[model samples]
Target: MKWSIVFLLISVQVFSQKIIWSDQQKLEWSNFKSKVKTMRNPDVVAYTHCGWEYSSTVSSDPSVPVKIKITTIFREDKSWKDPKRINDYALLHEQKHFDIAEIYARKLRKEVMEHIKTSSDYNKNFKIIYNRILNEYKDFQIAYDRDTQNGMNKEKQAQYNASIAEALETTK
Candidate 1:
């Protein structure tokens, strides 16, 4: 039996400098390694660049298990912050953004596993599912920022923090 392996790294933009997300690893001010040339918005304190990547292997032998790996990553070179305006609250907010990406990564893993079980053409199906989920993930990210007002509104931010934490717990 032969094994076919496929790998894909999808993101809004390509990045080489990245840190994989982990439960033990938390975001710190130092992680924002980029220096912003100009502030597009004066109110914006920081930006966290996070996304997901996946790879899968399929075995021709039905007895062999399929291998799918999904990873949530943060791009240090793409993320930046205003050091003067930084605070613990803002850092936590950025951490939650990374957590949100991890949540979506888990979602993608679940969908990929389900699709591969019955898919005759998993490669094509994987792209289709990935693209669909990617769109949703982007929209969700936008909504999160809008709802929390970029973590300015304490009440909304708290709500999102609780929601995101619950999601991570239940998904695990």
Candidate 2:
């Protein structure tokens, strides 16, 4: 009987907590890591929506691999069974940007610093592209949130749509 009360309290707390990562999330993270490794970007450690911050930078050395930290969302009224559809997609999307940036950086590194003493151009160009990517992603996210609102089972249709929209945006 005592154990049952404890179980009840724990269940209540859990249910009250916000949804975050799922089993599928772990697999998704692993797959993302695998794909990113292929991209050969050393500075990015991990990508995640939930973490110490939305995104951050890390140091790298020959002795240590650069890592990006990813975090999951905090407890909210939303369902944990269905996390944001765009969560992983967003990470992958950002990873691609990082890869592009790394490529651009590498190319720039090959040139003499005297040729372009300022990092302003690269920062500006990257910001424009990044904003466009994020904007389109947001549009998809809005559509998805709307689509998933009517489901009884809380299926992540919004997440699915967001993922698709992000992919299309990237490809374009």
Candidate 2 lDDT tens digits, 1-172: 9999999988975765433333233223323322222213333333322211123232333233222232334323211112223355444443333322323333333332222223443333434544554455445434543454322113464455455546434533
Q: State TM-scores per candidate.
A: 0.81, 0.28
Candidate 2 is scored at a TM of: 0.28
Model 2 deviation from native, Cα RMSD in Å: 16.5
Worst 10 residues of 2 by lDDT: 75-84
Give per-residue CA lDDT, model 1, range 44-140, as digits (tens). Answer: 8999988987676766665455677889999898899998999999999999999999998888888887776633446457788888888988998
The top-ranked prediction according to lDDT is 1
